[model samples]
Target: MPMSSKTMNMLEGLVKDSSFKWLLGKQSSFDEEIEEMGRSPSAGTNWIPELSPVANVVVRRCSKILGVSANDLRDSFKQEASESLKQPSLFARNFLEYCCFRALSLSVGVTGHLADKKFRRLTFDMMVVWEVPAVASQALLSVEEDATVSLEAFSRIAPAVPIIADVIICENLFGMLTSSTGGRLQFSVYDKYLCGLERAIKKMRTQSESSLLSGVRPKKEKILEIDGTVTTQPVLEHVGMSTWPGRLILTDHSLYFEALKVVSYDKPKRYDLSEDLKQIVKPELTGPWGTRLFDKAVSYKSISLTSGDGVPGA
Candidate 1:
């Protein structure tokens, strides 16, 4: 349903008070159009023309860059800038950012956003410069001047060229070329930079692997009888001087003490706490429930074992 007169008035008032107030600066295209509308009332019932000068320019440039029609570009921009009623400046910024992206799309001949690219490419301070070796420069110049490089592939390869400069820079061929290129090698210094990057990545991978292996500690097997079905469960074992940090298992046949360690190459040393010598020092202990539910509560346990009698040493 169309907006009622009262609702329309309220919306118009909101737009006039918020965005329109900011848009009507000292002198603008809108003001000029308003003056023109007053001068020529018979020109059209609408005050603004079908195509404003600014819109026309944006449409033509953006369409040409994207290989689309001016009409299509205008329609797309209008659809994207629908938020103009709420915040006109926000719509303006969106249009400008889109135009900037379109310019990049034109240069690379790829019509897509940064998220579409396979490799990472970031513009710092809106400036991207690379000093290539004479050989690399010659290789770049050999390509057809009209050809455009894919932005997706350019990060791994070369921008506006087919050469894989990143991979080439890591090769011994680059070192040989640099040595022969005289003092120009200093200006064309990419090998050492790439080598440093390679070393950093290798070191990161090594540390990651070390951390992963370090967490793989020794595990002890326990036989469980659940619903008359026997199942073997692997319980993670630890090794440390303090027994407070590790798990203390008490079975009908035996009492076991497993030490916790940061890294374990062999089976964890078990100190036998004799079942006969075991006693419930504290009958029951209280703690917070693991599930943290109001209905449930966790149990704390304390068991002391006499080591002087016949307890097997670790």
Candidate 2:
């Protein structure tokens, strides 16, 4: 649905007033921070406090429409509905104008169901992506987590709605997955970098008795970049969790397993996205918004376990 100026204004007021800061503590304050930034030195400005007005608008509208009210909208809705239903010939006027509260409740359900069907294809498209992109690219947006916020917004509006999402992906894009060997090797590489052996060994490798290479890929090693391959990846049937559109709208561990396979690693029963580098690699994974779904992948050097990141997940 198209947004109304009134709705935007309402959100602007909330942004200006520090509303909904708890949902995204720092993120919710972006408007104020930007306003303050405009008056200060430009260097090292805080960005968490400066979200795009468009994102704020989107969040505001979604929250309202999905019933994730940060204000008195719900009571207002009930009052307005009650007052309006008392009018003459409302039910006979048609579905929208139907008088009974039950009718209105059912209408919300039907509307949500209808919307799920309309966007079901895109949901499937996003779900097909096996892993989050190293970064978002046109071919494979790094789990394409944007769908999570939007879908969560949808659920807020229609809590009963099912939002089916498949793991989305293509060839040219997939997240980095280091093997146990890779981890072991990075330590060797880092140790070399820390000392004088890195450059010495490189020179030696080029002009030595044997034409062999040793050590590991850097934690910052780039994944596929040359080929612009865009194709569908096979889907996994299930995981520890069942298919709950509303739940997957927040996070899908099944897809994470598929992504683990993308890096040729097995999915840990639990994963952690915030762990620091273990043997060599640092921990970091895409959030659902970027993955186009809800799920935050966390990892550490020796292990990974997925847990609550405050954005619903298995």
Count: clashes, candidate 1: 6
For residue 258, give model 2's deviation from the true position in Å. 36
* Prediction RMSDs, each to the true structure: 24.7, 24.2
Instruction: Report the C-alpha lDDT of model 2 over 230-296, residue by residue, as the tens digit.
Output: 2132222222233211111001211122222343323223232334423222324333243424233
In candidate 2, stretches whose alpha carbon ends up further than 4 angstroms from where it belongs are 1-50, 67-112, 115-163, 166-314
What's the residue-level lDDT of 1 in candidate 2? 28
lDDT of each candidate versus the true structure = 0.32, 0.27
> What clash pairs does model 1 have?
238-259, 238-260, 239-259, 239-260, 239-261, 240-260
For residue 262, give model 1's deviation from the true position in Å: 17
lDDT of 1 by residue, 218-251 (tens): 2342211111011132222211211122223443
Model 1 lowest lDDT segment of ten: 222-231
